[model samples]
Target: MKFFQIRALAASVLLAGGLAAAHAQPAQPARTAVRGTIDQVSPTSVEVTARNGTKSTIALPADVRVAAVSIAKLTDIKPDSYVGTAAVPQADGTLKALEVHVFAASLRGMGEGFRPWEGADGKKGSMTNGTVGSVVTTSGTTMKVKYKEGEKTVVVPPDVPVVYLEPGDATLMKVGAPALIFAQKGDGGALKALNVIIGKDGTIPPM
Candidate 1:
């Protein structure tokens, strides 16, 4: 698949307690992506264990939102279809796809823009949201999507994970269920989930 070579801003990560001094330096943005199993959950927070064995606790604000993501196919992308692609910049100035997600029509205008993704591990990449203007299908798929800012070209390799979101309930956070969350480590060192993607049944979200 082919991808657009979208421009990017500098990527930085912020840690708690990095600005205690009067002469402190600039603080980085709090963007993170976490994928793991639900170790525990409560009214105030949830504990998750990463596949690599890293564990984190994230505070659940009163209005925490959740969604369910399911696998999609490359053919799922079509002209005028709303989608978002997360990809890393290649040395050749191309956006090499990390993953591709087709959006349900109801989410047409949600988080619609291209910018540095505050993904888990400070995902250093761009996320473009728009309607696919065209699709080139050969070995892989190349897509041209037009957003408010402009257009982006995204290449979707066959191996890239593709998913779409559906309404998810809090009960989807069953213990031992697979999940992924884009959150930020708050000042107190506990992560705060801004959005959550919970897997259904035994299916784990792959983006």
Candidate 2:
């Protein structure tokens, strides 16, 4: 082959190899939410007891973010407010909320959709994160939440936990408080904490 032809062929071969290598790289694991109580907390790690009684120890990174999910009233969720709720389908196809977390203005559009989630009961649940379109209060509170894809009408009982996220620190990691820790499992099965939402004064994180 001519000199120029040989050079071109070599460049193409190198490009193909690079593309193959890129395709072979494994995708990173997605983070999953862990709803449990903090059993122990150290400077480096945290031990949690899942609602089902299983124990998990997740590494706490130096920069791990902590937020307090404090108790709120159902009336706090107003029109156009962003919120997320975990609910289960009821007999009449309406959703019954297990817990609701009102997001701050900065987090308005985060996780805006409805997806399958696990409730406190450890059974099939759906999480809806969206803007509140309307709120009706009669015997109980009902909210019509709208998201990018769709909307859902959720029935919120008076006794269900309603909470909102606020700035928190490591001091909220005290034992016996209900916490929802978000952690990612590595390929080797070790879990590392990402963010944590803890409840204060006997409150439990609803989301």
- Write down the RMSD of all candidates, one decimal each: 6.5, 15.7
TM-score of each: 0.75, 0.75
Compared with the true structure, what per-residue lDDT tens digits does model 1 show for residues 80-105? 98887777777766677777778788
Q: Please list all clashing residue pairs in model 2, or write none if there are none.
A: none
- Candidate 1 lDDT (Cα, whole model)? 0.75
**Stretches of candidate 2 above 4 Å error?**
1-33, 50-54, 90-93
Global lDDT scores for all candidate models = 0.75, 0.77
